[model samples]
Target chain A: MSDRATLSTVAARAGVSPSTASLAFAGSPRVAPATVERVLRAAGELGYAGPDPIAASLRRGRSGVVGAVIGERLLYAFRDPVAVQMLDGLTEVLGELGVGLLLLAGDGGPAPAQLGRLPLDAAVFATCGLEDDPAFRLLRARRVPLVAVEGPVVAGVPLVDIEDRQGTVELAAHLRELGHRRVAMVTMPLRLDGRRGPVDADRLATGVYRDTRERLLGAREVFADLPAVETASNGIEEGEQAGAALLSGPDRPTAILAQSDLLAAGVLRAAAARGLAVPGDLSVAGFDGADLPWLAPVRLTTVVQPTAEKGRAAGRAVVALLAGEVPPDVVFPVVLRPGTTTGPAPA
Target chain B: MSDRATLSTVAARAGVSPSTASLAFAGSPRVAPATVERVLRAAGELGYAGPDPIAASLRRGRSGVVGAVIGERLLYAFRDPVAVQMLDGLTEVLGELGVGLLLLAGDGGPAPAQLGRLPLDAAVFATCGLEDDPAFRLLRARRVPLVAVEGPVVAGVPLVDIEDRQGTVELAAHLRELGHRRVAMVTMPLRLDGRRGPVDADRLATGVYRDTRERLLGAREVFADLPAVETASNGIEEGEQAGAALLSGPDRPTAILAQSDLLAAGVLRAAAARGLAVPGDLSVAGFDGADLPWLAPVRLTTVVQPTAEKGRAAGRAVVALLAGEVPPDVVFPVVLRPGTTTGPAPA
Candidate 1:
């Protein structure tokens, strides 16, 4: 490591200053074409890979990398098409900004230490819960510009919020309009403890995840005292388990409102397993207008949020923060998409 | 920026040496508890964020970040459950190694400049086509430790390969045993140029992607002169389009071997559209035994690759490379999962 060639060595060989060598390597117009050619020859001779990025970043005070703190495990996060679409939109803008996206596991995984050690010009809390977030504390301590997509509201950190509460309200209202009174909810994790079961009053009050609580509250607004079952994660299998738990009761609900499309798909499976018709016996609705091509012909009644645009908004906020400007909070609207899965209540 | 607090400023305020302040911030046992307290108090007073990670990384000659070069757009890459599973596995091991995974878009998508500027200890080529990869050349020039999952073989760069050719060979043989003589193929992108439709002899000969070519060759070995339709990307929609094209042709084949389960799902959709009964009028097979909960009661006959294990192997290889060891290339075996989608050819 000590013997590794530095820019100075290349500069000496090229008969130029270290700054001139750097300019030549950067392809800056200040350096003459002949100087750039001479530097390249010298660099090729010494096997120099140009300026060391770490050292260059130290001098520039920017890493050209933005960290996205994924709240769940990488597999679970990637499995959600909503997260993927948001990240895709984010990368599209970040690419134009010339910064790379670095994924850090946020839910008390390896993020705290990584946050302290890794270089990030800014960070976006993609899926982490808002309450008592350890990564948030560490980033704030480091004074790293922070932005969150659909997470908690902090004073300094600009948030890219969707109509989580409003979307579910509209979805519940739609089910209500269809003359379904017996309705139950399949909710995402109310807490980060990986608890999967019925959401008791105590758990509901102590819920740390903002999106889960807000969505649940939205549905409760339409159907107060709505019996809700919680999932360990926002996945299809979790939804299936929760769905089964809800349906097995002596008094099964006529309609089920899942927090996400994946969870709704699982509920649909549970409905299928029990030999019940989709809209004839049970009406199902979900959030997130995620593309479910396999569920073709049976379109889901979901709240279609602007997932990609939300990502792009977060990306733009990060850009604004990096430019030493404070970006305001952005809230996107959601619409109700009525599909084949939701219909009038059974006779 | 110039007025920002530095360690020296805090150290001076605490009446301590800069090195002592550094050790105190790192929570070194050598520093007395009272001295650590004094340093923290001074840091808080002056709004110092402890040690600068950029300067610290420069001193250690490590960035604590590993780059994963995704070959496709972030949305497309995340949409594939196989890619997600693989990345999940990679992140599991990487998290244990205390390193963060940075995503760099490959295939001439803001990667070359990123490769030059971002600090990465090593990189893994997750889904990029092997031939003439600009990211590969750039990383090689930077002398970054490289590991590839199912890509072209490069000297000194350890590869975590699957039984791609062999797995397809067995799958093709199974279809052959079913008395299917007229078999068509729906393949992943044979090239990175986003061309969709029939694969001509020229395109087949010039195909750069190893996995696509090997899988196609395996099927061709079982059924010589097997016609194949190429997809722009690996997705259900792409599969549906390709499936429609294959099914609309005058010479309809008795069986279709899709390169992926997503594509196979699309093929199933096309068959349903035409009122063709699966395994009765036409048998369909696919690669990658992905979990498709939406395609209930209809399991796909495909090859199941240990996607997560492949990712873990790549992670371990990166660890070994960082330890100055040349890890041997690992090739994992694949299994043929016989599902409900495939049976004896029609009549």
Candidate 2:
């Protein structure tokens, strides 16, 4: 009564063994109802509600938590609908597995001081550009199972990625079929230290984000001289900024291809501001066929990637690794969905 | 290395005490750099990377994770931009405090089995209608610090709420000032068992969700015979559905006020579908002045609640409680933001 009460103290007061008390707390079917009631009564009297989760986890060798490293400030990362949808799928699977999702600040990579203290059964690098994160190395050293969703396919780490190049190629093909000759592109950041500006060939060469580079390359395959304006982040505002910069010139491109739906929506806004009717004066298309309810009545021509499925696959891989099975890296396919946004180039 | 290596084995091999080895793994500054290096070398040889976080948490009496109980299905919950913004603010504060956020599924209440397994220093009831949740009771029994936002306020749990009634009253007053004689309202679910239909006075009387009830009352004060349509959920699609149901009648109200911004956006879409110009044919207003980038150019007249600030306040309350301080409950104010959506009620 003098010291902080524990399961042992409750067990001692209940005239039961420590294991019996633990079983009672765990709701083991073997324990008699009478014995469980006695344990509960004793626990109530000693203010010992149950066993400490920390201690229980230590004994079980599992923390019942999956650490999801989200890159960049949540304020920005969460704004992208693709990220939110993927997280939704991931949480759905993890919750079914009776594991809580622990959101860790990756900020493009992991923070060691933060990651070192938290208990995790598995660590998932959800953010891109995590090829050489020291924190990931630390997690590896700690023997934690790793699941990389959108980054470099490291050996032994279960990787989940989409066909970025193929998806972009399909998008470019859609534009080309629509007779879009002078096509401009609004791209996601090429560097971790990204900014909004015209991306030159040299900047593209030094790109760390594999998806960005792959998408750029795929577009270039269609249009040899594809002019692209890279945004600081994958957001509508930045997309709009890119659109304004590209369309302000007298020789505005007949069509604009944005990497994400959010950026594509921005391009739409820019077109509207310039009094250029969509598909009439210019054509616009986007990647990630995200269901943007707000952009209703303006269905975008986009490459639909299985974002939620990608997340679920990552989660299943984590489950497999935890079960001592080596799951193969998964690469999902992306397809083009031609919406009302893209049409034949203007006369 | 014949058996699975542990901290003790590494300590023995390094010629250091077990505590010293642990200190080295924890990166304690007190330990000499050379001694730490020796410990690391010994650990590498024995395949002991570091101390188990579970064991360290047990010894430290802290889990270093805050559990945020999000109600309803994650698919539906994450779709709500308001909830995501609040979570963004909550994470920003918790992350700054070196505490990882553990997202727990509340599903309208709490999943006792799931809550029981999570090791939490604090539990935040971010969802609504949790006055009598078994999961909350379990958390209380475990003596975890409690923080509630927008629900039945318990005696001890720190509560964070917005000026729901006051804000609604202000919105209604704005509609009245706009020379609107007949004003209809679209509300969020009144009860946990919500449906999409016209809500009469009896239904309003038996409503459980306090925010919904309060907002309805505020509107009634302005338009005594204010008819309201209750939606199954607070979504733009639902709002659109509600708008269709409300507007496809002979007695159509000139102005409609929706409880959330998403619902209001639906109303806007409904008007567009019916070939009614917003603010010209029907004036529409929404609540929770959310940053709807897609709803650009047509700025919705809404009551802007400081959602992020509310989340931050809840987080600060959690921090205070963890620091053994009883922080006061917070009641954040909401302000009316006049956009292009509101004008003098249709001629």
Candidate 3:
């Protein structure tokens, strides 16, 4: 085996103790300037790149990395503006804490093996369904600090949740006040299996996703027996597909409530393709107050959740857990934002 | 110190050797299933979560984490559909490789300290200026395998480059053929300093970002003295601000070529705000064949670079470097896709 140079070799070459050499490499003020320069010169000659970060991390007992277990594939999670905004906020706080954010795939992708072997100081269940997650169980077994965003409550795992149910209730109420009696719903995936179509009772009973179930239940509270379609994903195209399915029927509804802003945008496109004018022919409302600059002239009436704030809260929770403190669960409130997309239904 | 449960403790309780206990925990077929059950029962009673991943990584001499140095803030990078798509592709491959992706902020955010301490087997400069990067020097000094995506070439570092310069030339040629003598450009940041406004000679000379410089040079090759504006970031709002600056001037160009699709979308919005009809009054083109579903009805005339392919190439390069093999540099070709936004210059 090739003998790689170590700190002791550099220390011997520099005529300094190993501790002093370590101090010089760490830029400790206790080391004299001349000795530090000599140690660096010796290291340069020996091709020693300070200390192996892995070894140093072992000594510190912290990896300085926080893993974010995203529920969907990175492409899907990133495409969603809400997820991006939350990640942005989370990363901002993690940056301030001098830690790196490591992206780990959740149940939707190949994550099981990587989750078992990767060194993480804490793991955040960002944008994943809370129930029966294998990644959560693995991380918990490893005794890693855990945090979740918008999921069902798990004991000892702090959550950065939002008023998902209440927000949907408010949105449904707004459409009702607008005199829209017949309403249909376009939802995010009811489960992680990526199934799309009508939301039958069988699908509902087996639904494990917290946000999807809560939002559907909330809408049901206002319009009992509201016809709904479940999208394969929370995207514009999926929303459009769901919209077409509802509109093609002879008993087309006046309003469509989508679980995400991207889905609502798709539904609007579907309506436009079918020669339906929003507010005149159909009313649409969406969850997540995402800033869609391209969807101009026609603003979306949606439930505005504090997406970034939720991410920051998750980051803080991780920080607190790492510091050996149990962080309080954070639940952010959502508000109903009325826009051009929703108004009085056609008489 | 408290006596924490170790592999030895579990082995002692299970009446098996330490190696056998470890093999059992790893679910190795060599270990008898009966022995594995005994080990698990012992582990459950003692509260041992397999082995410490950090120590295991030290023994294996691999962290199984690839660091991606993003040039901008996570929020801004995620907002750009091109970056998201590339990340999606990169993660897909990394998932197969059983490696976790650690997101490291480039010179744009807080990253230096975290970079030094994080245990990364390899690092990819995903979207950043290649010149004078402290993170690059740090990683290189640590002897970590390195790859860059669309940046200036460095010795021994393979790049997954796109035809950035050639793509712009094609778009510019298309515009010139359409009788656009006067054309302006909106660029991604010429430098990472977050400066915006009219691109001055000083900004042009000090430009460090390779994509921005290459694309500008390509446009200059076609339209020598093409007026240009630089954006603070590659975002729609930034693009709109730059577009407003370009259009508000007395000498408005007949066509505006944006370096990115998001920026192009913003420029289109700016033109709409000014009541200028696309193709009839002005022509707009963008780079990066990003899927902007929201920007429907008005297809952007731009260069379509294989963005996700670039990301996959980078991932392949990282995999190669980790396997102690030198990977070949990959350069993807781009094509011009003419859309409704570009047309003959108005008389």
- Candidate 2 vs candidate 3: which has greater TM-score? 3
Over the stretch A110-205, how does candidate 3's per-residue lDDT look in tens digits? 469567788899989899865888888888888888998877578988988999899999999999999999999999998877788999999998
- Kindly indicate the candidate among 2 and 3 with the higher DockQ: 3
Scored against the true structure, residue A22 in model 2 reaches a CA lDDT of 92
Candidate 2 lDDT over residue span B1-347, tens digit each: 29768889999999999999989987899999999999999998887767778888898888888988876666666677788788777887887777888887654222566677788999787756445666778888888899988876789988999998889889989989999888899999887575779898788877767788888888888788799999988888999999988899788888999999989999999988998888988999999998888788789999999998988888899899989999998999999998898889877
Model 3: reference contacts kept, as a fraction: 0.61
Clashing pairs in 3: none
Tens digit of per-residue lDDT, candidate 3, span B269-306: 99999999998999999999899988888899989999
DockQ for each of the predicted structures, in order?
Answer: 0.61, 0.49, 0.60
For candidate 2, lDDT tens digit of each residue in A218-282? Answer: 99889988999999988898899999999997678999999889999999999999999998898
**Best first by lDDT, ranked:** 1, 3, 2
Which CAPRI level is candidate 2? Answer: medium
Error of 3 at A227 (Å): 2.1
Per-residue C-alpha lDDT of model 1 across residues B230-299, encoded as one tens digit per residue = 9999998888899889989998998999999989999999998999999888899899888777787898
Q: Which model, 1 or 2, shows the larger lDDT?
A: 1
